[model samples]
Target chain A: MSKNLVGNHIRKLRFNHNEMTQQQLADKVGVTRQTIVALEKGNYSPSLELAFRIAHAFHLPLEEVFFYGDDPTQ
Target chain B: MTYQEKKSIVSLISAILIFGFYCLYMYPQYPGGGLESPEAFRFWGSFVLILTVVSIVAHIVISIIFNIVFRMTTREKEPNFADELDKLIDLKAFRNSFFVFVVGFLLAMGSLIIYQPLHVMFMILIISGFISDVTGSATKLYHYRRGV
Candidate 1:
């Protein structure tokens, strides 16, 4: 199994999508901008529901956004 | 920082200050035994009064700062275990603090047997609890800062 649970180049994607800001995406996803920043920075992993919202916002598949691995906190 | 992070930092700092005052000033001035010497009575009475006043003032200051910055209350509610990550963090911190508390409790028990003084044992227990909580949060803060 893969150990690299790290995922996403959300900042890159945002830039590709016309300089879309973190606040804009967070508003669409019903979370605060700090949460979006945390997600983008890989400091936080979103809930499945939040993951779906993020993927939906980007018009992409969930696989393109996040990946699973052993609990990092463990 | 998230609300939890802000609240944790505030509580840790407040505890450090409280403990700092106790160790630096109160302990040295405290009388040797639990007897009612004039110095002991004066210091103990003032300590009680200062503790009450400091606690009330600290709560007000921390409450206002936390509310403004993090939208938290004085007696903050237990965090809603909203996600797996949060639960994991909580568990790690809780376990660490519990271990610390147990060690402190054992030491206090041993000292109680030797000194035969309930007051000394109680002080040890109280200090132990505070130290445990502060260290637990400090660990969590380290993880949070390291982008866990």
Candidate 2:
């Protein structure tokens, strides 16, 4: 399938937050590690609720956490 | 691979194996009566019923075994609950699977309209059921690997 348009800085943000692991972030956001992995890999666009939760996990605004573009996540 | 991916693969393989072995075991039991005979009808009825029960039991046993192996190899416990992603993928899988079965049901009815033997219709229905099961598993695997 084509890559998802929605992208996020979850991997980088997780690291910035004391090098948090995928499982830890998933726990904080109430999702499975696979969902976190999918979001970081740009394979999925989380629902608004899940997106907000992830943003809250990083203490960042939604725009700062997620962006919609062809730009790849670093 | 992640646990979800691995689980999807195991499900696909197990579905194939279970259906294959069950068909093999049942093939020799086809009734000797004429295609439209009462015995033939009874055979098909029991066949479908037994197959459903067997598939359910086998899948549960295989899932338990797979969990044991996964834990031993990866040292990670299986997630006990389905999350949003899992639910989404499952819904898509079910949609595809149901679509396939509906098509098969139509074909089976068409066979009767065409004056094909009753046994032919039965076979079509049974094969369609098997294909739908496989389709569901394959769809889950595809979405898990390639994205929603």
Tens digits of per-residue lDDT for model 1 on B1-148?
Answer: 6655665688778878876776577777777755545666566568657765775688689767667655344343333333444455667778888999999999889997796555566567767877787788776665455445
TM-score of decoy 2: 0.96
Candidate 1 segments whose C-alpha is farther than 4 A from its true place: A1-4, A68-74, B1-8, B22-60, B66-91, B113-116
Among all windows of ten consecutive residues in candidate 2 chain B, which has the lowest summed lDDT?
B30-39
DockQ, each predicted model? 0.24, 0.80
Model 1 chain B poorest ten-residue lDDT run:
B74-83
TM-scores for candidates 1 onward, in order: 0.64, 0.96
Deviation in Å, model 2, residue A66 alpha carbon = 0.4
Tell me the interface RMSD of every candidate, in Å. 5.6, 0.7
Supply candidate 2's per-residue lDDT for B127: 92
Tens-place lDDT per residue, model 2, B1-148, is: 8998988888889888998999899999988857788989999999999999999999999899999999999998888888889999999999999999999999999999999999899999999999999999899988888888
lDDT at residue B134 of model 2 (Cα atoms): 91
| Candidate 2 wrongly placed segments (more than 4 Å) | A70-74
Report the lDDT tens digits of candidate 2 across residue range A1-74.
Answer: 89888888888899899999999999898888888888888888899999999989898999888898854444
